[model samples]
Target: MDNGIGNWPTIHRVRHPDRIALIDAANGAELTFGQLDARTNALADALARKGIAQGDRVALVTLNSPQMLEVVLAVAKLGGVAVPINCRLQAPEVQYILGDCGARIVFSSPQTAPVVAAAVEGTDVSEIIEIPSGEQRAAGEASQSPYETLIAAGSTERVEADVAADDLAMLMYTSGTTGFPKGAMLTHANHHWNAINNLTAVEGIGPLDISLAAAPLFHIGALGIFSLPLLYVGGTTVVLEAFTPDAWLDAVATHRVSVAFAVPAMWAAIDATPAMGTTDLSSLRYGLCGGAPCPVVLIESLTRRGIRFAEGFGLTETAPIACVLDIEDTVRFAGSVGKPALHVDMMVADPQGEEVSRGEIGELLVRGPNVFIGYWNKPDATAEALRGGWFYTGDLATCDDDGYYRIVDRKKDMIVSGGENVYASEVEQVMHRHPAVGEVAVIGIPDEKWGESVTAVVAVKPGADVAEAELITWTREQIAHFKSPRAVYFVDALPRTATGKILKRDLRKRWSADGSAVQR
Candidate 1:
């Protein structure tokens, strides 16, 4: 059996025992590669002792921390799958993921312990491991004691993983415009190839390189984009508990972060930060932007500051890296996701999966080892998404004359707010629960701060009236706040197509311009 990526820590430990593997930004605590390997071995043994063996599901729901990755690697070492839950999700949303994946153990932090507790109440979760947060212990909280005890009890002997290249390693949950979220099954080889693609796309990524894990690790953007790839390449990763413009700037300056990846919204925030001028960015050799269309202005702004900013595009199903723009071509081809990665094969194809002519809008399809294996336990979805060895990305794009690709539209009509994917249908499902809501269509309105703001265009029930604030608050109670509508507009009736389908495009067009919205 192939050792797979589970052996990364062990290999690096032998290769660079004294090298720093991780830096917890919360408190400047560092873990050497040797210590990291020993900890992962111990955690793996502890998990095996708890009845978690190969192919078992383990969940992690916590803020960004070095321990989060430690748990992921430990589970990987045991040939188990790690499910990282979005901390922003409410109990039901969290419960659905935990139950869907049938996770038996969960990792939580002091800040997110309550939500984790509520989410695992009726699930298969039998054990909860609280990761240290470097914060004062909350009332009734034993912050780092649980993990410390487990590590102490577990044997530190090396555990060779019994996994294959295509064995499922992670089940990443991503929602579509309709229905519940689907878990994308990523194999160990998929992640390794993605790391190679990133290393090849971004030149000079090696042991000397250090990256900041600023985005939430639950999202593939932060996990696969830079941090994991860096780890695969024996580089150091700095973990952040949360993202703030000040925190981001401080990480780069203090850690001498050589490479960083963040969404365009974050880049915009960094651009707007007053300390951008004073912060010592001399160590930042390269910056990558994705998760949304990057404005050329932002690229130019960063370039003007002497920071090379490149752009790329992909989805959770693609192991998150398919197309990439080299740092040299970032400003020249602004607004474009550059070309497909050196190892990835991409084509703009018609509905029939046939390639469309250049410059013609069509669905973007990608085929490569980096693509995910399938959706967890959903063969029908797996079949539909992966046909002819190409993952049909429901994104409208066109290949230009210069062989560049730009995303024209999100075919799923998904909303990306502040680097988070908010499915319209999931939010709409909650919004429809409101007694006053008759019909509603959720849309994303472009915002300078957040890449897009979730907006609701609703036609209330006849003779039933509700304040916008009331409806917004109602949705927040029922769903994650990030997915809730930032602005609610009242309409007499929702525009529809001949088939009675909601015309979301027209709603977007009507509200996207002039930012005109009705409060009631």
Candidate 2:
């Protein structure tokens, strides 16, 4: 009985080999527990034969597919670190991550092969594996060896590696808000306990429950909280390559998905879709909304339909789940993110790191086995973030006497647009590169659809002309499209403090006061 996550598939294979473990909704493919276990064992052997040793980093830049899941499990079995890249990232951003992580091998789908090729051109990545879709290529039209080929050629005999609970399992990259994205080193224990917390948070989940993975798999909220936990309990996971309202609703109705997790924006979009009303969603037992503050109205709407919504709070540094608004408390604590998860300790602290009184606003700090070990190769950042044995979440929150916690504001300048984290500094850096831009400040403004929309307030250079559309387009080309500003506001000068720091709160107020922010 291996104590690490690497053995989960093997355990389930022995217990329930005939159970369906995964269902690829896009292609209508299924993988039983026995099949998944055998495939992952073969893939692990193939990776070891390719010189991928324990503790080495392997990057996967592919969409939602069974192959992606296979790669994740295979890496775990090999005692290697899995770095799942956000498929929406631009080439430059992807290149930066690959270089930073020192990944020796990268697996990308044919759809994203061009971007992956460009990103790894100058990086340390030595081997590139192309995961082809089920469609077979014509004879003599073969390119690089397909993912299936590796699985077919390798042996199914389990490749055992010395793995422990404390060993590093994953390198989850945070959205680089200030500069480059930092990799949060999550151990096997961190992920194991996180799965336990997720299971405990939502009671009554059993082997018969089916979960939907509609959100991007790169995110911990989707993979860690939803998919992995369900797998631990021998439930089936239905995966979608990308989120679409029609596809999500259809999967739920078709697969009888009992549990699902999505960001607030996704929930909003699903509600707007005509299929949402027509589709039979009675099979869904509950759903989770997180990544940004979910609107109370959205929660109420979903709850009215008998789809219980559990809002949660956490970060990449905390294995992505520390608190969850259970279904029982959703109505009573309508606006809260709920109390700390099982075995997780949370506190509100002042600037001096002292715990604040109940009902007082302060930074939220968490301590638990699920907390990540530290940022990969970033000692200073790791030390600063994990001070006094607590992970500083950089979120301003208040805890009521009833123990419910509500987020007040963000201590860090981050924008949560459509459930994706866009660091104000990362967007501002690209905006400043425009020749006509003299100064730029990025802030998140309240949005109805997206929890918060990324808005850029800019001051044009003297005697230069630049349209808002052009600036937005320029920024999109530099980073992921989601991080690009959805609205642009022109200003004569930005308000700054005596120390020459731009007052973002004032900019947010100014934009809110007047209706000058132009949304595209």
Off by over 4 Å in 2: 134-145, 413-520
Q: What count of clashes does model 2 give?
A: 0
RMSD (Å) of each candidate, 1 decimal: 10.7, 10.5
Ten contiguous residues with the weakest lDDT in model 2: 134-143
Most lDDT-accurate candidate:
1
Q: State the lDDT at 123 in candidate 2.
A: 89
Q: Flag regions of model 1 displaced more than 4 Å.
A: 136-144, 175-178, 414-520
What TM-score does each of the candidates earn? 0.80, 0.80
Q: What total of clashing residue pairs does each candidate reach?
A: 0, 0
lDDT of each: 0.84, 0.83
